[model samples]
Target: MPGIDECLLEVMRLPGARGAAVVDWTSGLALGTIGESPNGDHEATAAETAEVARMAAEQPVFAGDAAVAGPGTRTPGAVPPHPPGLPGLAVEDVIITTAPGYHILRFVETSFDSSVFLHLWLDRAEGNLALARMRLGDIAERLVLA
Candidate 1:
């Protein structure tokens, strides 16, 4: 399996892919990053993305949803509540915005419970959103950190 650096490299290979970063959703820290603009700060972006994910996970609507519910009624796969200013959502992947560009955030389902994800920034003009999503999914599956 490829590591985070290799995964980001693959993402950069995608058409219209401008930059990519592997982030820790819990702490909003970047594990690795590539292709970012000189002035474009990825750390802040990762932090903000993490906050969004956190908020989405905590919302009552998302938490109450049956899809997020685990095997039994007692067990829920919902995101835990966070402190103020944090997102309350459980983000699986693919957050796109027309204003800036396509922001793909894919959560890493690892055995260690690291709560990490891939944050990809792509140019809408040259990027195929659907293909990018699919590729990211594939990359996520292949990632294995040493």
Candidate 2:
């Protein structure tokens, strides 16, 4: 698996990639960052993105039937709650499209708390939304935090 720096380098290789960061959603901290931030401050960007991630992960709507039925309740055909150590929901990524750019928040599943996610900023004109999403998923899986 690649470490934080190497993984970020790989992410920046994507076309139209303006900035990238590995963030800890629980604390709104950037573990690593590269390229240029949307707001000219990577830390602030990380904190803002983390808020989005945290909200999405914690919402019961994203948790499916399991969340509505209560933690341990199960219906005959309902999807199960997320596995322990995973997010409360099974959200893989969140995408935000603007007039000029795209923001992608790809959640990272770790052996521990699973609170980290990879954030990518891509120029809408030059970025391939489909390709970036797929590549980000691969990068998130191989990212290793120290």
Candidate 2 lDDT by residue in tens digits, 33-52: 99999999999999999999
- Residue pairs that clash (backbone atoms under 3 angstroms), model 2: none
Per-residue lDDT for 78 in model 2? 56
Give per-residue CA lDDT, model 1, range 60-81, as digits (tens): 5554334434435433554444
Residue ranges of candidate 1 with Cα displaced over 4 Å: 37-39, 67-91
The Cα error of candidate 1 at residue 12, in Å, is 0.3
lDDT of each: 0.73, 0.88
Predicted model with the maximum lDDT: 2
TM-score of each: 0.77, 0.86
